[model samples]
Target chain A: MSEVAVSIEHVSKKFRLYHERNQSIKSAVMRGRRSVHEDFWALKDVGFEVPVGSTFGLIGSNGSGKSTLLKCLAKIYYPETGSITYNGKIAALLEVGSGFHPELSGRENIFLNGSILGMSKKEITAKFDEIVDFSGVEKFIDQPVKNYSSGMYVRLGFSVAINVNPDILVVDEVLAVGDTEFQAKCAQKFRDFKNQGRTVILVSHSMTSVREMCDSAAWLSHGELVKVGPADETIDAYLDSLPGASAA
Target chain B: MRYLKEVLASRELLANLTLREIRGQYKRTIFGQLWSLVNPLASMLVYTLVFAFILRVEPEAGDPSGLDIFAVWLLCGLLPFAFFSNVVQQGMGSILGNVGLVQKVYFARIVLPLSKVGSVGYNWLFEMGVLVVVLVIFGAFVWPWLPLVVVTMVLLAIFAAGIALMLAVANVHFRDTQYFVSIIMQIWMYLTPIIYPISLVAVQSDKYGGLFGTSVTILDVYRINPLERFVAVFRQLLYDNRWPDPQDFLLCAIWALAAFTVGLWIFRRSEKGLAEAL
Candidate 1:
């Protein structure tokens, strides 16, 4: 059997940019003059692979489609062309405000967000208190999340996200919101996942963290893959090609 | 087939999302979920005072409807219309509102619109409770037939859900589907025998000598509108304490099935583009 955890083959995605969204009644009526939409490709035939049990890093500039690629792997954004295959159950923490109804209490959000990631209610019930404890918001867990601080909110979100026991995990740059202690905890969790021989895909702009945590890395620029292979070497090439970092 | 399996696999998520939607609507308010009943009652009072009293428009009489109170008769049509309208209006906006979840998670896309349907159904339950109280107060309550509302609501919700799913996908791209929906629903309300009875259309059709130069009566043509049959069922069962034609149930079934299957087809066809489009 193939040991690949995720394989992407020439995948692409496009978006429509509306010149005028025409959200109002008046604008819709006035829009009869011309078409107000344009198609923009966000990913242009990008592809890569992550072997089982390895942490893979996806690095790129802001518009280089790093997050877009992660979304495809997470099955949030369907590829316009080509295909992506995954070998096991997948979970993703795409970004903050991952649709935790703000009015819901932190405890309720744990169940809500967990189920959204495909966890069953019985599974969530089994680990409910453990999740709240890991988030370190035990006292405030019963209160509506709208009342929590941004850090508390993200901490609770990250806590619920990381609790899922999927065979393959996808993480965006949501860890940037966490404090140093929680970041270290996440780093420890990453090492534990690697120890258990599960796949982890991480998307980050920070080359240092990518080199530190990932066994292999893929670099993308403008929705196209520019490099893939050993983490340290890929980061080195990506940095050397940058406008200023190479000269420095 | 794929969407069904997806929904079945993520049934727990659907339930959770539906609960979230139901709770979120009442969370911050002092009245909390009671607002569901309060909302429809408030609208019922305003229309009752205005349409039932001020205008003194004569309701179609000589039918089996026991209640001569204009408000009560109006409600039989109005409440069902209200339920249908609420589902469509809210269901259409489901996808746009949940772009946060839609763009983050991997699960059945149908659950998004269906969750809105579920929440509105929850509110409808409470509204029905208030309706029973109102009917008892007016002495028009039929104890045995009350459970029949459940049957009509299920069919109406399915039809509404089908339309909502289509609108949900469309609104994600056009951004104006909901706005257009508001205007269209108003025109629809006038056509569906909500304020005026179906007999009004029948009388006019007879007067006009059958529209389009055919002998077919206007009520027959209007009955082709799915909502007209649904409201008629509500009127017969709840307003008149009489049984709806069993054959009319077949029409309700056909419309419900057609809406559901077509809606799911459009949803699946558009599902792949949803994330990119958003």
Candidate 2:
């Protein structure tokens, strides 16, 4: 059996729900609400493992903590309890355009986003042409990203993100973007990642993709993991539990 | 302490972000980076028109630096103060501005404010270059201590960064801290003797030396403002054409260190929930 690439144990993340825009001092004084927020556990006692070279998918309904669990793996959000351990470098695509400056050119953004993702300038330089070629936006690379169409924007973000060569990649549902051609490219890229002995943990609502691509999957419902096992079994279990599935 | 090391380790991110900020500052403008030169130069012209030509404070008999051109003296103080104010204001608002990255990514949070301050250095360096050229054209080159001017800028940055970190963290929650910070900086510029002269404080304090029946001169209390010492260091470095008194350096260093320490304390304390706070 391959070594576990990521081991998440009893992970829980809590977020405060603010009543309104009260972060400003004037609002605090005017509203007279010193603590104007309540606590929420986005993820509750969730546990799972992603093994080396395996493609794992986190399948859950809306507000079911799929993204939160993925973020915990990416270390973007700290868990309130337990721990997540990663064996290798992680590159996460939590959202498109989160780090991109609309005023900067696509070329400059590659450098900026690459550096933020922990790649050095020289590494980005070496992969620069590949990234540009992969994104297929060479015609407007010099123009600021603000001028790019929404499709080009997300595609470029995806291209740069995957090109960074992460050992453990945690991809949010943002990959469900781009045209059919780009989606095919992403599918091919997933196969290439599996061939190279890298691990991938994808969070997606698309059951077909998860069933086809994931070696195993975890189903989450209402901030708790419902099942964890082989992809088909888990997806089947998840679908069976859905209220609409019984009628069908 | 661990935060310091994390920030240090993330120096590459800091450099890139600073470059991003510098480039973004002039992205849509036709002038581009030239705006860096234009901003301070324009301010200098306006201030010179008002403080130098309009006010026209004549040289006293025992004037410390014989060069009575208020423009040069005013630029010396104004440039540094402008740099300080920019650092503080931008630093405080930086986290909120980059809330996109703050919420989605995980890195050292201090880099947000620190890079804002670092980005201003790009503009300040160009502005200082222009200042040196203007001084040379005016035939008042303080050649030897010119290198020491670099030290003064660095010290000012350190002092500014410390305060920026504190304000940035506070602004993450209060949001009004940034607004109040600008107002404070405005009032601060007036009180710090940038438009007039330090000698004015000396003269006024002597005329009404005892405020509230205390023997202490108001000048003594006015000198307590560390920025006065920072600007004084720059003055001695370039305008006065002499190495500053070691005491000036000491006070500035102490302020820089103290502000940095306290700022880091607040920053580290608030770092955990930065995304939540914002």
Candidate 3:
């Protein structure tokens, strides 16, 4: 009954891995019968909810459905069962250059990326200078993003996402891509976002960052929710459960 | 009606995205935006040389007295066909190309395909302008049936948009859509009679003595083609210097409307899986 920014109930997502992922007529009709596929469950009856203006953290190893759950919340994947409901504007920095065009200049990519992210031209135009300055790539803004180094690419991408000011911001290990100073800047932005009463979903493998930033955390293991509670306690539990902890 | 209105309301995004696409293509190239014009002109030159000289061919009707002769006729067909072809090819890749955007953002997915359709149509208009100048050079200075040409171009845009919407969404799920589409379009060109007149079908049907003794004129078959109705309207207004045949325009509109509605339905239904597939 409490106000919620995102609500999830028993959502599950399954993917079928075809032998060849054949899409041709010859393949669809002929190879379809002969094709072998294994159904992989990326999520299994996963359930969680984030209250309005609360930060939520998802912690898990690779393939544990942290990103998959985020995608569902973003409406990128429809669950195979159950429902996910979300309210308010959303911005996902799941990966660097999620919608960037390699051939387009960094300046041009801002507009393309902004519009795709649901920002009006006016909104993007107003924040144009701020974005370029924050990215620290002012000189190369007019040069195509294709020419950017990986760090520069991440910086430009992060700059745009940070400027959008969406109600719910989802970050998936993107902070790990930059240098130390930029990482500190991103952490500060997260703090600013929380102070501004926005909902934040941070997925990271860095236990220290999670303990420092997240008030609450949820641990997912093998596509199941193992624990959800205070950040320090959940991380302690997650770390204790690791196979090599005792041996080490 | 509601969907169309929504698309219209979102025209700004569509225009911006279209510009993005054209600019994106030419971003690093020296002749960035000019390539839009250059591409079609290159094709026109090849066609003109190959047909006018090597094959020694001409429009079946020779030339309309006031209509800029064969150039207008050829231009009328070539420009629209180029627009339609570009939309299909560009649109097929649109969803795939913007997989990142579609996956991360909550905006209307239709914008991707519609923008491709609009930009290619915009390019078509520029090509049409050049065609007009070419006609003037040949001493063909007749004002076309303006209203008819506008209506025809609109129908052509809607039709191409419809096809693109369906293809773009499908291409995301089924990667093989490109191969099928290319082959389909190759055969479709011959079937649509872009380079030839529908009159040839009439002569052939008469020579073959009709299908099972029931006479079927190539003209009637051509009339049934949705593309033909739009092309006919274009040809009549632009080259024949006649006002649009209202009946033909109405029929073309109906077909376009139907295609657009169905195309949206297909696109929406398949959209949920695109991110996963990509």
Chain B TM-score in each of the candidates:
0.93, 0.94, 0.87
The per-model lDDT (C-alpha) reads 0.83, 0.85, 0.78
Predictions: Cα RMSD each: 2.6, 2.2, 2.7
Lowest lDDT sum, 10 consecutive residues, model 2 chain A, at A69-78
Each candidate's DockQ: 0.63, 0.59, 0.57
The best candidate by DockQ is 1
Which candidate number has the best lDDT? Answer: 2
The sequence of per-residue lDDT tens digits that candidate 1 reaches over residues B61-121 is 4246467776777777887788888889988888888777777877788888889889988
lDDT of 3 by residue, A63-158 (tens): 899988888877778889989777887877776666687888899888877766667789999999988888899999989898999899989988
> CAPRI verdict on model 3?
medium
Candidate 2, residues B42-106, lDDT tens digits: the string is 88789888867888764232123345566777788889999999999999998999888887777
Listed in order, each prediction's TM-score against the native is: 0.93, 0.94, 0.91
Docking class of 2: medium
Report the lDDT tens digits of candidate 2 across residue range A1-248. Answer: 57999999998899888778676787888888766678898888988888999999999889998888877776667789989999998888888656898999999999888888778888899999999888899999999999999999988888888888989998888768789998899899989999999999999988899989999999988899899989999999888888898752
Residue runs of model 3 more than 4 Å from their true location after superposition: A19-21, A31-36, A246-248, B1-11, B28-34, B49-65, B104-106, B139-144
TM-score of 2: 0.94
Clashing pairs in 3: none
Error (Å) of candidate 3 at residue A29 is: 2.0
lDDT of 3 by residue, B1-278 (tens): 77568667666677778887776666567876678888767766776677665775456542353553444566677778778878988888888888667777656778888888877877788777777676556665445555656767888889888888888877876778887898887777667756666776767766776556667655666568787777777776666665667888788899889888888899877877877778
Between candidates 2 and 3, the one scoring higher on lDDT is 2
* TM-score of model number 3: 0.91
Clashing pairs in 1: none
